[model samples]
Target: MLNPPIPLNEMDRLLSLSDLDLDYAAHQDSFKDLTKLAAKVAGTEMSLVNLIDSYTQWTISTHNLELEQMPREDSVCQYVLMGDGSFEVEDLSADERFKDKFYVTGGPELRYYYGIPLNVNEHNIGALCVVDKTKAKELNPEKIELLKIIAGEIVNRLKYIKVIEELKSNLSEAKQTQKKVAHDIRGPLSGIIGLAQLISAQGEDNQMDEILEFMSLIHKSGRSILDLADEILSADNKKDKKTPELKGNEFNLLVFKDKLDKLYTPQALNKQIKFTVNTSLASETIPFSKNKLLQIAGNLISNAIKFTPVGGHVIVDLNLITIDEVQHVLQMRVTDSGVGLDEKGIATILGGTASSTNGTGGENGYGFGLVLVKHLIDSLKGTLNITSIPGAGATFEVNLPQ
Candidate 1:
């Protein structure tokens, strides 16, 4: 028997199939009645809903015969996937392509066959086929039309399954984002609580200026926390596909640097990595999204520290250049002396694929932060440049409009 020709878009078809994660057996009930109707309409003894994957032809649902899953090379359904419409053999034993010694010659002595490709999202993934032991002169036109309609229904069911799968995947990603948001808020919240504790401990013994300074810091940090909630953690943003508004507020560079120092200094120390920050800005307060900057800086520095080996150095440089009266370009560079990424690792990060890698100091991290950083940069209409040499060091430079 002749083998089936492979489709030109085989790689893409397989990728689409993998994303569906189709298990026809698990969803057999959905197609059982349809398969039965298809067999009865086409006057065949057996009918099947078969999916051809990279390695196997899986009969997800069957009528009047046992469910058979065989290697793709051995299954006739593979031929249907290569075409856009139905395929037929009036007598299997009469056709060279299908006149095999197994089913066609001895087992069930299958004679007649008809099948239509099951197309999903423009890719022919499988087939809806009917087989009979008796030979037929020709296929009935009316029956073929009815079978095509049934195949369409089957395709609809597959589309529904795909939608459900996508929703589930999106829900999972949302949960992960929620966890990261909570983790992000924890740092500023802890600083707030610590400031409160200090004010309580000093009581009336502290001077008015000292108390006012503590209160001012608390207010700035509190505003930053609120901004995180309103922007990053908003429920409305999730429902809509548009980018979240990166609103500009009067942001203090000194405060931003202080916050980063408070959050990452101890983390660096714990890992025995030296951390340093240098700033050269036109003004202490500028028009920009403080929360977005914090996210961009926090994710970069944390990743730098995580990947930096013991005794290595992580440095962040903040430089702002005034362009016009209303616009300023803030350039932030994060450099790390760590185990840098190879080409594959860089490609994976740039592709926005979530992956986990063990750090140089043995810290474990899912690369979600890098993905978030990319998103924020894109939302701000900014640019990011990366340069790295594996086993030596890496640098991440971001230029954002303020």
Candidate 2:
């Protein structure tokens, strides 16, 4: 028995096939209708949409036959990938290439075959084929033209599936990020309230110096929060700018560090947890989105303070390390001495699921903060590492490009 020859562009063809991420099971009905139409038009007993990969011929869709997959060397449709047009065999018994094959000689004793290459992105990855047990002369010039049109439709459907899959993924990411940003606003708002209470108490004692300092910090934090909210609202109102929240701009890291310290210090002191923000930096100016960094760092510090018991320490260490001559990476580490995470709890956090647990001070959380942090890290093309023991402590390390 003669086997089908491999195409010269086999590597590229397989790569393109895998990139489609085709889920044949989900779209079986779509392919089934097309294959059914091809068989009806060609007056054949069976039809197949066979996708050829490195070693297997996958029957993604079929009509009038029950088939799944087979070796590439044993597939009659593999030969269609060698040319740019249809491959037809009027009588399998008379053709040397497939005359002694299983389907032709033993299984179905198929005598007629007509196939069109499924072309996409300058590659023929598969074939749309029809087969019969008799040497049929039913595929006229008009019928062949109709079959080619159907072949184009199959490729179009594949392209549509890729587009839809991408859209769904982008939509999901946007929704998750938005939720994280909304939750982040609560941090600064709480800080604002704390500062106001402090100012009122200082006013009764006529401590103008401290009151003025607190007012300055409040103004800056309020402006930053407003800017973040405006960006989010603009992105929602403007359908074109779907991801404006991720846009980057130049900002001073020192200013950001001060805001973070002011925001979390009161909360930590209220809980009797020692919160320290340590920074070792060669440059304070970083070309990255300030709001995104704020959200990431805010969530980490908040979680640390929440989990640590009274008299425990929660430290935030930040530094800029050289990645190359032209690039630097911002490394932020948050460590806490409190009830740490087990392996299962770590998995739930990293898996982007909500895992609710009460804090050492009985503080409640939505449990999606870590999930949001992970998604934001991925979006920034950064890395996150977590280390913890059940009762000792936990440390979260994040490195982002600047």
Candidate 3:
């Protein structure tokens, strides 16, 4: 059913290979002219120099209504292979070998057939099949000699097309290489961006305020570089070729919350905002990479700080939850008591999705962080959730299996 019976007339299926050459001619300059010359020289309605493969007969050049290609079993060229010289059927229906063939009855009602094999340099590529609906003009020795000469030129064209395709492939590869280089550089570039922000925000002041700003820059820039590097390195795994090793370790949520409070202090001061960290659960330990865990916290904390207004308070609470009725989890709630996010932002943060938007202070970041955070949490067998009021603030919760 891949190629349901392509009905060609006796001549169409026979020399109607003309369409093959015509269709492909535009694609390759090497074989195009040869097909046209083969048709004109034979004075046929359709003609083609074909390349017979295992299952299909393809044309290098074609003229008239012949097909671009057809199944070898269905091809008139397949029948022509039985003879040495041009296989000529002045009238196919009257011929014993072909009268029973489907094409003579309901298919492209082919009546006349003639094809001169184009074997050259040990390659039996195809034939210069000159076909017509009416009886073909009887070929004399002179015409047969001319057919041989024309077929030779067609072979030369095939060689040229092969070379052209090779060149096109090389050009495509080079372009992809250039695109990959640009994509790889985005990671390191983010580091530079963070450094630049620290310097600019400092405004030539070597004061404690400027140094703290610089430190926050280092934190953000370092995390961004690591995330980018991780993605670049894990791309092979993401492509389904390998499994990524899960990375985690034992750490305290209380201490982690304290670090966030300190890191976000500069941000809070800059916006004249109040930042708070509160927890009612017992301070316990859990297994997860501290550095990566910090990033997950940093991304959420930074986002909270970014959206929170001056004098507005951001509360971070660690809640203990039971998981699988077997163990306990130290879930962290980072809630910003300022302007909240839309449903879309909540989905992105919880689901690790995407969008393009600058922070409140014109801070630019690739929203891919949320996506990475989601993958990391899942890798650690954890669930993340986000809740928010339009003008109040947002609350993000992380639930992990103990």
Candidate 4:
């Protein structure tokens, strides 16, 4: 005979609780102990906790039995879900409903059976059952009550597992977010420190105008750092918050170049590497987030300088390209003659694997810089392309709508 059909309403609830599709068999020790306790309390030789889905019956916990699963059509627990409470079969071989069943006639020769439905969120999903080969008397009232209580405990344990899994997932996400924030902030903070030190060592003969300009740049870098920190904190607190409005400031190309020059010139000079910048943009001002743009540019340029040999060259090119005779796009390209990336390295880095290595100058790198740059470009709705040849160089091209 075919198995009894599950009610549509209960099936819907079972589908909704998909997160409870756990492999309880992998954690057999605790569940085996529960099954043992259950068998002793109910005075049964064989007891098991079985989770019944639409297609199969999975035995999560079992005592005095080696059975693990069976087809739902052959499951004895199917009858248990048909009622509001515990179900019992005093003699399966004599019962007309199961006398011809394979489990009764050929498998386990099951005769006496008793089961309590395991319900979760009003859905009858499984059962805690006990079976025996020999015909046994009907369960006493006290044994039936004990089986019901054990079933409730099993349901509670499943709920607890679900909660613990969610907490672990959240904690993993929090750690990744923290790592990203730290990686992004490091570039700008280094720039601020370097620029401040340059301003301090200029001595008494330093020109007043140059001193003021340096100080202004320092202030801007400090504010940018604070803004980044605030944004990260806000994201953590309000996960469902809508994306904030883009804060656009008038970005001057000359000022942008000056900042890059201050940040990378010393490093390039110390390595005796040639550094060059070429621009073809006619516009002086653009509306964009200065700090975010700086981070993208600074990170790429720093990586170029760090990896380039003493005689190698690093180049930055900027241009404004008109698209479809209407929209204008800013194209920035950074090319470096350094220890380039092979296909595997490029895939690992772009895939956010967080791989790290030392540069040519023995300068350490966290390997998260390119990952952060890619994330920033995505936020700006920009496109980035990478071209590289091992032992030759790598080129990064970025295009953003104006």
Off by over 4 Å in 2: 1-3, 23-26, 195-402
lDDT of 4 by residue, 1-402 (tens): 332555556434344334363543444665777788888877778888887643346687889887766545567887776666888888999987789877789867888888888888777778898888888756778877877888888889888876775666567566658857866786777677667756756633566677767676786777677677767766655752543222223244555566566556665786789988776656434333343665577668877877788899999887767675447777789999999989898776566454556678665444545765676677678888878999999998988786
Cα lDDT of model 2 by residue, 1-402, tens digit? 333476777656655675675543346676899999999999998899988754446688999887766545567888899989899889998978778777888867889999999998889989999999889657789999999999999999989887876676678577758956866885777677577667766776886877777676776777677677768756666853442233223335566578677656766876788998887766554434343675578668778877899999999888878778668888889999999989888777677664656678765443445766787788789888889999998999999887
Q: Model 4, clash count?
A: 0
Q: Write candidate 1's Cα lDDT for 1-402 as tens digits.
A: 243467877655654555464543457788999999998898789999998754446787899877556545557777787779888888889977778736788777888889999887789889999999999735678888999999999989887876876666567567658757866886777677667656746755655677767676776777677666666645655743553222223345665677677656766886788999887755545535453675567668878887888999999988777888768888889999999988887777666563656577554443356876776688788888888999989999999887
| Per-candidate clashes, comma-separated | 0, 0, 20, 0
lDDT of 1 at 145: 92
CA-only RMSD, every prediction: 19.6, 21.8, 27.8, 23.8
| Per-residue C-alpha lDDT of model 3 across residues 114-229, encoded as one tens digit per residue | 78765544434467777666764677777778877887767666555545545655675564475476567776777676776677567557556766766667767766766765
Residue 67 displacement (Å), model 2: 0.8
Best lDDT goes to which candidate?
2
* Residue 339 of model 3, lDDT score: 74
Each model's TM-score, in the order given?
Answer: 0.44, 0.50, 0.37, 0.50
Judge candidate 3 against the unseen true structure and give its global Cα lDDT, from 0 to 1. 0.60
In model 3, what is the error at residue 199, expressed in angstroms? 7.2
As for candidate 1, its clashing pairs are: none
